[model samples]
Target: AGGRVLLVEDEMSILKFTARMFQKHGFQVHTTAMNGLEGLEMMNRNIYVAVFTDINMPVMDGFECVRRFRDWENESEERRSLRGGRQFVCAVTANAGPQGDRDRALRTGLMDAFVAKPAKIMDLVAMARRSAEDTLGHSNGN
Candidate 1:
């Protein structure tokens, strides 16, 4: 199994397309959310190979969500011990390009990667494949 992936996107079309692509690439379980708040809620329920989140959304934005997620992961001894590190969070959004988002995310240690919108969805699948392999190597599963 490819394990699970969490997709946090406000766009309905992008969300569905991304989910199908991940499934086609052999990911067994896919969890989806329309906004960062919903994304954070999913985080509490299951471990993911990777999280692909859009930068903009209602109620909560990706940056804040990732910040909170990192905080929660750090605070949760159980999670830290089980995973051995922070979960992979990748930004998948229209705003990811030409704005130094990648640099900012890296510098701030908020997100691990970024995929600008309208690019190859294959990049995300490939990343998930690598993440799943790496996660399985170190993790005991959730």
Candidate 2:
């Protein structure tokens, strides 16, 4: 079986492409959301090895969604224990206006990784693989 993943994007094309790329790289099951609000709902009911969310979207932007999701995730010991490792979520942005914007987002620590617009699928897949390994290493308190 392949890892489970979630793709939160408003653009249909990007969503489809990202999902296909993830599947090609061994993420067999992936859920999609058109907005951040929907993304949060999906996160509440499922377990995903990774989540790729666009920074800008209607109905609750990526930042807020991730913030709330993290809050919910850290709410209880049981919830945290249910995971094999740390929560992994990536922020995808098309903000090429300034490098400071990207740097600020990273400094916020809301996501495990960040992917700029026109990102390379191979790079994304590689990062996910590394993150999964690192996260899983913390499983069973080992």
Candidate 3:
């Protein structure tokens, strides 16, 4: 089943198209800017089952956003379900499979998956489904 999605994107066109796709697939969608800081703030305010964020932006990059989100897990007692254990964050970048970028995302423990830009609709749907399943498992105390 499709789940709630938090989309952090800088590119307007991509964001619009992706949002549309999420809607078509029966997922609830929330959106934020390219800035990691703002995205973090949004996550704190809402409960998303999964997040899809871009890698680069003007104010704060995706890497920094992910880092902050991961860091939040340590310092806070009240973790928002939007940004909690079952919520997955995925990198949707135009890095063209750059190993360093992928490695950085992995090392930070922020992203659960990475997909190159212009991602296939099916891929996005599949990831969202997987995230939903994972979240259900966590919710069930698994």
Error of 3 at 1 (Å): 6.4
Alpha-carbon RMSD of each model:
2.4, 2.0, 2.3
Which 10 successive residues of model 2 have the least lDDT summed? 96-105
Name the candidate that leads on lDDT.
1
How do the residues 1-142 of candidate 3 rate in per-residue lDDT, one tens digit apiece?
4778888998888888888899899998876565677787877666676788888886888888878866775565666332334357888888846576677777777788988877887898888888787777766767
Q: Which parts of model 3 are misplaced by more than 4 Å? A: 80-86
Per-residue lDDT over 8-36 for candidate 1, one digit per residue giving the tens place of the 0 to 100 score: 98988888888888888778545468899
lDDT of 1: 0.81
Global lDDT of each candidate: 0.81, 0.79, 0.77
Candidate 2 structure lDDT? 0.79
Number of the candidate with higher lDDT, 2 or 3: 2
Instruction: Rank candidates, TM-score, best first.
Output: 1, 2, 3
Clash totals, every prediction: 0, 0, 1
Q: Summing lDDT over every window of 10 consecutive residues in candidate 1, give the lowest-scoring window.
A: 95-104
